[model samples]
Target: MHDHGSLPALGWSEFLTTWSLQPGWLLAVVILGAGYLTLRNAAGPASTVKGWRVASFLTGLGLMYVVVASAINGYAMALAWMHMVLHLTLIMVVPALLVLGHPLTVIAETGPRAERAMRSLPVTILVHPATGTLLYSLVIIGTHLSGFMDSMAQSTPLMVGEQVAYVVSGFLFLTGTIGEEKVRPDLPYLGRIALLVVGMVPDTIVGIVMLQTERDLYPVYSGARPEWALDAVRDIQTAGGLMWAGGDGGMMLLAIGLVIAVVSSPERRTKMTGRFLDGVRSARLAEESARGTTEGPAEPGSVDPDSDEALDAYNAMLARMNQQH
Candidate 1:
């Protein structure tokens, strides 16, 4: 039964006018924006922060508010697809933009003590690419697969928690993968690509489950949906389709961007090639060790395999192999 008092059908005009104040979210955005601005200004004229990065951070903060306080949030209860949009934006788009802004780098710029803290052990572990990737995958799979979404509908705090989880997981994942955050070592381009690819598995699984399931998975949404809303089954299917395509598509674009970065930058290209050669070198060394060769291990503080001399040696070895072949 449609509640006549429920929100009117979500036409374009209604969407434009249908925003809620969502005081809590709005306040959070204000505080974060103000804090970022204060920090940026305090970083002083000598600080090397770029204007675009500052803008990106502020834009992400603004988008966080818009996502939770806008008509999309209002319609999410009725529209599974809208919820997925919210989910993806929180986990992927917003976090990526925020990472690009390099907020942690900004914080580190304040002082040597802050820089030291940012690069401390605990912080390093927290932002490690592997850690972030695992957390992102778990959060993606767990929330959608478990009873959390259904429970979220009945509890305001759960709903907020869900939103928070999405943003935090995304931020952590992207911080490790994308930005020059002082908290962690820079992940290799190949490592970043792998992390993103692994992250897509949960998205694909959740999307497929939602899309293909004939059973109505989310009763709360089905029950609460206004008459104008899509039927329960269709809503989920739509949401699933969005999740599958949007999730994979967004990640693919990011992967392509990473590939482009590697291709365009001499340093990145050399690093990538060197990493591959290093793996091969390690395998050969292990083999020789197993065979009881007299060769010793590399010394401490060895030159990076990505160096020009290393590249020339690797290429020469490859050319020799080709000639032998």
Candidate 2:
């Protein structure tokens, strides 16, 4: 085990030496890369899978590997702060990148059968905004409970399961909110902003509670003492602080990005304008109908017969009637 206090001086060579292989992570990367390539090729002459999207997907895969198989993973088992870093990257950073890459869209575009699967009712519900938000919140809150955290840290299999939960929850949260792909219950720009803001509340509460707690929550780290004389309590506090700040900061950035995307997209702007106009028209029609009910409609041809305006109107009406006939 490495000393926590010596974390700063842990050179790249030393970090590389400590790197571990996670077969699951490796397999995921291979599958993701192959899927992207296959989707691109299968998309016919005009591929929707852009170069940047491929890069983004690969980058997400790299981040997952770093959190699971790099030296960071080894240190995370020993240090509370490192563990927090790993969790944040897995849940916040990696998910955002992967969602932006539009993985579901790529899969759907793979073939007719894949498209049908993507459109299934179960998949639709899984990606619904409400379902995703609830599941994400449950995973975050449930896993962070003192007993659960301690149990997970003690068992390697449990830790792996916890990591999987984090990735899945994070992916679900972002799949319908941030990405360009259209999922079930597609939210408007304002709705997406509201969803993000609401989601931040639980994360903020968890962070604050962890930071304020006096006693250590996870006892698994007591045996993994650092040679550099690290203070476990202080490290735990730091981890809580990171969780609080990182979670809120990441969500805020995503919200801003969503706002920018809405503003920049001509199609979105047009749809918003159309909705606004429809609303205005509806309100005006309602007002006119109410007025008509309260009073009464004007008698047909009620204009003054002697006035030039009435004569012009009559002539125009006659022209229109003749043309229709």
Candidate 3:
């Protein structure tokens, strides 16, 4: 057997070279540090710290794995195709699992006002139906049909832009799609299902690209396939097809779990739904309040006729769940 130690050290840009201070690795360290802080913060003396610890650790691993491929292959070598693959894991796979580690609920407990704001504004913009639909379509088409994927491995600047787009879009999709309670007041199980179905469109395209492409489009990496004598176009197409078919298929399965969550998670699910409704209430209230539609500040003790009893009940239910939990 060849002595593994005899292998000469490779430079940073040289494929399969010794590990070095590459940008992707540096990016990974930052991600790991952030997740570490997230877990560490959530683990404060009393709570079930195991969840955050595990979540943060896994998130770190997921990020590192994505970056590792880039680091070894050379950042900007192929305009960033590797980074796209990395993002597939970062935004889609990792966040879905990491949220279960408990940092999200801890974030919920950050008090009503702050939590409200964080989940509002920028967060709300993304969580909305229009934005989710837009993002899902873009993730599907932007990454594939638009020819953006090929350059991500070639240019660092474009790669950064791609990453920025992917992270923002993915995170928004996840939070709005997953732990939407803090942002939205009331989301039904079916509604979430609809959104996830939208999200899967991108993956479906990815798979189709792989399955349908007649010839390899990216010759660089596919040409370098380690052992497999795979055709470049066919290989790229297969990757897209796998992304389309398997990725979305996996997302659908995850959606099933989310359905269970909406059905079973009383504290988390109800409050989230209620809060979204509360936002609707607040918006309407602002509208009415602005137009002075109520005639006058009602006589002290006078009940307003427009007050919604269901809203009151929903609010009460949410309060009780919070206190009880």
Query: lDDT winner among the candidates?
Result: 1
Name the runs in model 3 displaced over 4 angstroms.
Answer: 1-87, 98-113, 180-183, 219-229, 262-325
Rank by TM-score (best first): 1, 2, 3
- Candidate 1 residue-wise lDDT, 1-325, digit = tens: 2222287988999888878899998888898888878877888986677999999998998899898888878787778888899999999999998888888888888888988988899988888887788889998888887877778877788888989999999999988767766556666777788888988898999999999988888876467778888888898999999999999999999889889888998867655534556577645534433333365544422535545645655666677689999
Give TM per candidate.
0.86, 0.79, 0.60
The local lDDT score (0 to 100) that residue 196 gets in candidate 2 is: 90
Top-scoring candidate (TM-score): 1
Give the candidate order by descending lDDT: 1, 2, 3
Score candidate 3 by lDDT: 0.55
Model 3 Cα lDDT, one tens digit per residue, 1-325: 1112222333444545434455664676577557655645654754443555555646645564555454433322322243345556655665555444444445544456655765767766756666856875686577666556555435557755665565556655665566444335445556767778877766776667666778766544343343323345655664675576656876788788887776687654544344456466555444433333456432322332235743554456577679999
Model-by-model lDDT, in order? 0.81, 0.74, 0.55
lDDT at position 277, candidate 1: 63
How displaced is residue 262 in candidate 1, in Å? 2.4
Clash count for each candidate, listed in order shown = 0, 0, 30
